[model samples]
Target: MGGSATRSAAREVILTLVVAAILIAAMPLLIGTYTLTVLVIYGMLGLSLGLIWGFGGILCFGQAAFFGLGAYIYAISAVNIGESTLPMILAVLLTAGFALLLGAMMFYGRLTDVYLGVITLVVTLILFKFINSTAGPQYVIGEARLGGFNGIPGFQTLNVPGDPGAYIWGDALYYVCAVALVIVFLLVTWLLRSSFGRIAVGIRENETRMALMGYDVAARKTVLFAIGAAIAGLAGALFASWAEIVTPTLFSLGQSAEIIIWCIVGGLGTRLGPVVGAAGLAYLEFVLGQQSMIDNTLIMGLVLVIFVLFLPRGLVPAIASLWQGSVGAFGRRRPVRRMRRARHG
Candidate 1:
């Protein structure tokens, strides 16, 4: 059984790799520029959720606050400095700072789990409402208006240093987003395999025992919350650059809920699951939303219900089932000797 399980897991991993490669390889030719941009955005946001919910066990509801802040920061900084890269750096720093401060307040106070969740959610909603209500109150950032509810538009393209030729910044933007996603994913995966990450999992699995084991549980959670928020902020900046628009909608409760749904629907703990979930839902929304049926909303709700009700573990686990199901799909197959020989030899 152990060998079979290992073999099954190996096959599933291989399959996922192949699928990712195929999708990426086909992306340039199969999808239009707009679709490509959207997919990249989905992957980026999903990666953020993947890091926070999947590994850190921080079910933050205010990630959108960082996200929107990053966007506003990037937009504001770019307008002020007239440079794209500078805004990115500024956005990252400012967003990380915000996350750090917020985490210190909440996590230091020993608010965690459900209470932590509520605090984050409330904070995020407050941000959303504030931004929505104050889009155009106008602080002069180097002679540029924030444009408030109007947000910021017509931002400068990224300037790669020392490059000679003209570049389609849009395509470069997609690649930038993709490359960033890959790097962030690798980093998170490595972190999870580290002692610190293991401690996080220990907190996730059993925080009290970990605390008794002399771990600073609150500090750990706080650190993770900040780190996850930083990632989320980066994602928001990317989204702003890719879409060339910043909106209060970016910080809304809907945005927060969607990240949670994506993580949950994608097999929350796994690295790739949330990314896949984000991409899958985006695809579904794009395709299904084209119709204006009376029951369209109802159908979508039902689908969500069905997935949660019948397949609790989510899409990744369902995908892992493919190997087992394939074996069963053969019905009452060969003898053990034959099966072993076919599988190994």
Candidate 2:
């Protein structure tokens, strides 16, 4: 029995490995640079949520603030310095800084799940209000309009030495984003399996016991929050490069809700599930939106309602279970039919 079980598990693993390899090998041929960029952004967004809500056990509703902050940080800095990489680095740092401040203040004050969620919402709304309302003055950053509601356009694209930018590229940015998505996925997966990750899991299970066990709960939460924000900031930079536009929408309540939906609709606690869910949903939205025959909002509403009702854990496991059930049902039917034939005979 043990040997059979082991062999069955190995077969499952091999099947999954083969499928993944084939899909990856054909991705460049199957998907264009634009589509690949969108997938990369989706993966990054998934990783961001999986870190905070999934692993850290923090239901952060303020991620869009960091997302917007990162984009603005990159855009504003690029306008100032006329470079992309520096702006991205600054965006990460600035996002981490704001996250540390917000997390320290809220977590240290003994805010629990619901209240913590509210605080995050408030933070993002505050950011949205400030940015959306404060644009339009002649505020100049040494000659560039902060651009305000109308974001700056005609920006210089990112370029590396001995290499071309995305605009002047042979799928370089797509490959860069693909590399980043894989690296971030592996890094976050490793983090979730580490000692720090265990402590996070402990906190998620029982913060009181973990705090009593000599762990600085607030500190750990704050640092993890910062880390999550930094990752989200990096995602925002990728998004900016992909869309070539940044807006106050990034800090809007809707934006925050989208991240929450992505996290919840994707299976929480598992890293890759969310990545797949985010990308799958995004791809569906994109494809449907392009078709004149379908109303995407209706499609999204139906998907959200059905998923929330039937598969609260989201699409990944839901689809997996459906596939398994189909196979098992057929097998069971074969056995039942043979039994019926024997009884009739």
Candidate 3:
């Protein structure tokens, strides 16, 4: 039964990826490349938080810290090294390392969940303030200067592997972001099907029970947190490439809050919920941005409230429930119809 379940999960992931590939190929025809690209990056960012918070039950309020770190790290490194390949790698690894350190401190210290959230939020605020304060001319890292509120721009963006001069932008960058998001989605799905992932879920469900069952819950949580950070870092790197800039606003409280909202609005425990939430809400925000008649934050707050009160399971799970109910009703009606025909005959 276990093996069968694993196989089923694997098949589901494969099918999902195939569908994602089709959408990636088709979406460009329907939406502007720039809009789609930003949505893809945001979707990836949402997935990172969803994985750790939804599956591992680690509610990190500072995910944007990792995201901002990734962008800044990549920008700084790319500027110094004059190539993007190594900088992107550094962005992911260094961000993950930072998360691991922070996670270890929080988990092993036996901090309460509330405190964990507070600490993460505080850390992000600190980064935001510190980055903004670096406007002075002396604030320099190698060839790159921390431009403070102005942000770091004009850095080398993503390039084809083994060729630094072959810059990827516009449609190529959009495709790259879409493909990367899909790959991360697949990897996260596979991780959730693995033993470690199962253990992490169990820990999320009942931490005390898992601890009693000889699992090192702290270590597992720390590792999961780091993995999530790594993913956010990758998304940040992609965003940096697309925008060609890195700024302190990336670590702002608003950015962190937006990520949580995405996961909540999408569906907490499901894999696709975060992506759907991120893309849908982001597109909504984009549309709202073009109009001055409505306040974006007010609109988002209202949406969050509505979901929390009415559609608590989020859009995906709510839609899934409706679909299942309709299918079941149809099946039941078919059997009744067959019975009636037999009786009539």
C-alpha TM-scores of all predictions: 0.83, 0.83, 0.94
Instruction: Write out the backbone clash pairs for model 3.
Output: none
**TM-score ranking, high to low:** 3, 1, 2
Candidate 3 per-residue lDDT, tens place, 1-345, comes to 989867776777788878998999898898899999999999999999999988888999999999999999999999998888999999999999999999999999988689999999999999999999999989999989998899899999999978999999999999999989988988887787678987887888789999999999999999999999999999999999999889899999999999999999998877789999999899999999999998999999999999899988788766765675678954445444322221111
Per TM-score, the best of the predicted structures is 3
The deviation in Å at residue 228 for candidate 2 is 0.8
In Å, residue 145's CA in model 3 sits off its true spot by 0.2
* Candidate 2 TM-score versus the reference: 0.83
Residue lDDT tens for model 2, 202-321:
787789999999999999999999999998898887777667777788788877766777766776666666777777778877788789887877887787777788778766555555
How high is the lDDT of residue 175 in model 2?
A: 72
Q: Sort every candidate by lDDT, greatest first.
A: 3, 2, 1
By summed lDDT, which 10 consecutive residues of candidate 3 come out lowest? Answer: 336-345
Quote the lDDT for 218 in model 3. 95
Compute the lDDT of residue 55 as modeled in candidate 2: 70
Best by lDDT: 3
Lowest lDDT sum, 10 consecutive residues, model 2, at 336-345
Q: Would you list the C-alpha lDDT of every candidate in the order shown?
A: 0.72, 0.74, 0.90
